[model samples]
Target: MLAPVDDVVAWGESLDHLLECKTGQLVFENFLRTEYSEENLLFWLASEDYKKITSESEMKAVAKRIYAEFVEVDAPRQINIDCVTRGEISKNLSQPGPNCFDRAQRLIYGLMENDCYPRFLKSDIYQALLEQQ
Candidate 1:
């Protein structure tokens, strides 16, 4: 079973605030197209249609729907961030991707390379932070 994402859940508003920033918009876009799952919000929020994902493929299929909505509504440019929590992380990790961990790892690295957190100390810390992504 997955643990709760309440911390990250609580962080959603903060995340939304972060996403509202210019850079955040780009990050949200990249997140929409990449490995992140919109179903995280759906599952946690538990809307009528969201309760239907029962399998890995089902999750990904639903995720595509969420992804479409996300692209149109969340991010208009090409940036994204990992707003998922451990539980949501577990759900996505449960499904198959082209090396989900590795992909997210590299995604973080790429984001850093592109200077996502321009004020951050350095790119090395970004790679170290990839373990969380």
Candidate 2:
């Protein structure tokens, strides 16, 4: 549903990363699965470097920057075959904490071992990209 000329143009030109209807539904399911897992919301909240912001504007800005810098450029396939095969996406997308990165690394390694697409991230570049905005 998201494949089209307009989507391509919009993605190139805009920082907005709002999910389409179908994608939103899928994300909602993933979120639910994560929330009910052994490691719940508080687990993620505890490990966050910035646990709380002083202002609503700051919170929105952080979300905006994260969406623009990480989600946009990496085009990280949030929903993937590993997510499906392991039944992880249905129950792991919401496992809150620094462990999210660790999970991604594990998935990336698995994909590489299987000769599939590799996902990688450089923290320095991510910092610079967020800073520039």
Considering every candidate listed, which one attains the maximal TM-score? 1
| Segments in model 2 whose C-alpha atoms lie over 4 Å from true places | 1-76, 79-95, 116-133
How high is each candidate's TM-score? 0.24, 0.22
lDDT by residue for model 2 over 57-80, one digit each (tens)? 554555344333322323332322
How many clashes in each structure?
6, 1
lDDT of 1 at 46: 25
Query: Any residue pairs clashing in model 1, and if so which?
Result: 26-79, 27-79, 27-80, 28-79, 30-79, 31-80
lDDT of 1 by residue, 1-133 (tens): 1213342223234544433344443443344334344333222222224444566676566645444433223533212546552234345534634333333344444553344333232333323333344
> What Cα-based lDDT does every candidate model obtain?
0.38, 0.32
Candidate 1 global CA lDDT score = 0.38
Clash number for candidate 1: 6
